[model samples]
Target chain A: MKSRKSLGDSEELKEINISPLIDMVFILLIFFIVTTVFVEEPGVEVQKPKAASIKDLEKNSILIAITAKGEIVFGGGQIGIGGIRPTVRRLCAQEKLPVILQVDESAPGALVVRAIDEAKLGKARAVFISANPI
Target chain B: MAIKRNFASSEDMTEINISPLIDMVFILLIFFIVTTVFVEEDGMEVSRPEPSAVQTMEKDSINFELRGTQVLMNGKNIGLGAVRAQVSRLIQGQDLPVIITVGEEASAGLLVRVIDESRLAGAKNVSLAGS
Candidate 1:
């Protein structure tokens, strides 16, 4: 009888209380959810020009990249100047996010201008050109 | 409450299965951790002139024409280094609109640098035009 009672005691001790673990996990999950901003990133990188008159832009805005070869990229795919208006319009319809143009230093000015004009036609709240601050 | 029934079922009813809940929470945590971007971009707003909003050029407005890699004012080449000094001197104490007419083949980098210099020189309204 004593051996059986000891076995029961060991079993009870083996059931480690996991409520605290669950509570910790819950806190972490909440933290991540609260701090997440679901902005679609442009996958390609470009050599941005350095400028003294730059400021921090909104974190939740649309990002479009212009490569040195004059390719307009949005969310890892190459899009033409004609694509800007529809893409920006579709995104802005869900939420009014500003459009950010990350242009390579050597990119063509005409393409950049067309992209900006298309973004405006898409009803972007504002348009910005990304540059590295000196 | 039935005391006899509760006593018989005490061991089995005390613990609830939470492995699935934990699995779900872990998945959510991993997804968010992966998607988070820590780099906040620094940029400048570009207000391009629209055809409908074209107003008559001011008498004191400054005109800059960017062709290829050269910056020309009234067909005279002013090197990039001279942009700031010349603009500051030209603006003096008045707010003059600076208009940059960019050729289709001009480099975006040079245009941006010129715009930055013009702004630094205290031009209140810097606008772009296409040639």
Candidate 2:
């Protein structure tokens, strides 16, 4: 092997620095984490009844909308009424996500109640009605 | 020159110390895991009660939204006057909480009867939609 230069006396070797690389990685990770917005999945396509005092819903719960035409839409799909309970049950068993009920002004009352019953069957602790700002 | 030197050393020595990277990755994964979600879709729908020319509800009373004179609690349909009992059950110890919802566009009287039932059920808090 070739004789190595005198490491210190010749001033040829440099310090092994990983601080800058670590710093750069940290910045990128932070940016990715910060800019990411977590949007909750709305389980149904129910038309929400409008209210004067309703506020823009905070996006941390599953939104379940029931349309006036009796379409049970979820995650943007139309599910029939009989399919609701088991679906909610399976979903809650998998992940106990919050449920928000968005009912249109023209929807059937009993149907709206049925949705809430399903939400209860799913073991959801709270079911919020989606209301609009007046 | 300094940046180039750092890059050069990193490229020359191929093996990366992945232990810390793995640890960090797992931590982030755990965080997202706890925060992940599944959605539930139910079939219930409600047409908001419409506005009518009626008396403004009392300032301190609980409101109930009943359909066809039937009551509801947490989405389950209950019998007539059942809403008041349910409201009392929810707000038993506290004063009546203000319950506000629109009146059915067709029937102002039905909404009033529901309001009356709320009072009978001991609504320390109740309110009607509009006058």
Q: Name the candidate that leads on lDDT.
A: 1
Q: What fraction of native interface contacts does model 2 preserve?
A: 0.00
Give a tens-digit lDDT track for model 2, residues A1-134: 23454555556545466667667666655655664546545454433443332334434556666776767777767777776677677767866766676666566555655666677667765555665432
Model 2 chain B, TM? 0.40
What is the CA-based DockQ of model 1?
A: 0.61
Q: In model 1 chain B, where is the ten-residue run with the lowest total lDDT?
A: B50-59
Error of 2 at B79 (Å): 20
Model 2 chain A: ten consecutive residues of lowest lDDT: A46-55
Which candidate's DockQ is highest? 1
Cα lDDT tens digits for candidate 1, B1-131: 69988878886786667899899998998888888777689988887764543565545578888989999987899978888888899999797778888888888899889999998998877878777
How does model 2 score on DockQ? 0.06
Q: Measured against the native two-chain assembly using Cα atoms, what DockQ does each of the candidate structures obtain, in the order listed? A: 0.61, 0.06
Clashes of each: 0, 26
